[model samples]
Target: MADEPKTPVPESPPAPAVAKKAAAAKPAATAAAAGNDAKLAGRTTTAAARRPKKAPADDDTSPLMGRRGWMGLAWGAFTAANAGCLAATGRFMFPNVLNEPPQQFTVGFPDDYGIGVDERFKDTQGVWIVRTESDYTHEAPGFYALFSICTHLGCTPNWLSAENKFKCPCHGSGFRPTGINFEGPAPRPLERTRIALAEDGQILVDKGQKFQEELGGWADQDSFLQT
Candidate 1:
């Protein structure tokens, strides 16, 4: 009778209540994880919003902000200021004034001039003092001044010591020692400047007052001074 082999025992199945509890706990865990992820995303968004933004590289609000531009501007200002100062200094040093030579000027005493044509005043006064024979033979000799300007075109003539005459370079005009034009396109003789005796007995030459030889003004008493 060994009998009938004992029947093998069957394994017990899991309880439905336990399975339900585990499934519910799985849903709770998934919701908790989703909430944590949402919190992290919110923190990340807040941090990004709080961060400071970077500025642009080429912020050219003003020209002086750039290195090269600032240097150039500064240099230009400096140069302009220096130029203004230099101009001001020049104006101060040389003020606006009439610098023309006086029309009436004094030479030296009458005794200083000699009996011959004096070239001393040729460069400075543009005149030649010529002591010639008196028109009145009995009277003392008189002095006359001959201008060096050319009669034609009003050009200045140069005295040629070798030729004993005045030659104009502009038109090749020639003049004698007595200011008489001998050659070239000279219309007439060189004119004479007026001369007078000052209160101090000094010789005064008035360039404004002229004497024309054709007009016989040279024979006037004021034209010649008695030596």
Candidate 2:
């Protein structure tokens, strides 16, 4: 058999070299992508770390008064209101009372007083015991109690021994020893209280029974005590 003429085989181009280059470029691209992802993850972490945190609620971080403090203040106000109401109720239940002196009282005996104005009971009993040799209106020797109040404006009169008169410091009203108005703004004579002798010989003065000279009440027998 004659040798067949051999055809020249074409040499394949460097496919392995091209494939290796492609493989190497793919790995580089993957590495570049990985680096970009790593950089993005780092940026995200930094941004998250830099962001501000949220604040607590108002009840937990209030600037003025805490929740417990506000509650305590409300309770204190309620207690004070209750106390005030209780005080008002108590005041309504029990009212105020005024203590006044007795209207009837006893002085000393007739012999203890001289034949002049006795001012011993003036400050304490609001009366002046006058023992007279003869009364101007009754025309008899007796003892009478004159109220120490002035007839002008109800002011207390001071007995002046040197002047022999009752002088009111308020309006300068003057009264005689017998309680007769003598000078200054007195509308009428002084009033007389009931004078009597007690069972024990003491002078019993009853302020509840009053006698006015202008009203002719001095003529009553109870207005004077005969010594």
> Native-vs-model 1 lDDT?
0.79
Measured against the true structure, the TM-scores of the candidates, in listed sequence, are 0.57, 0.69
Model 1 reaches what TM-score against the true structure? 0.57
**Per-candidate clashes, comma-separated:** 0, 0
- Using lDDT as the measure, the top candidate is 2
How displaced is residue 13 in candidate 1, in Å? 44
Worst 10 residues of 1 by lDDT: 131-140
lDDT of each: 0.79, 0.91
Please list the residue runs of candidate 2 whose C-alpha ends up more than 4 Å from where it truly belongs after superposition: 1-63
lDDT, residue 220, model 2: 93
**Residue by residue across 126-155, what tens digits does model 1's lDDT show?**
887776665332156767678878889978
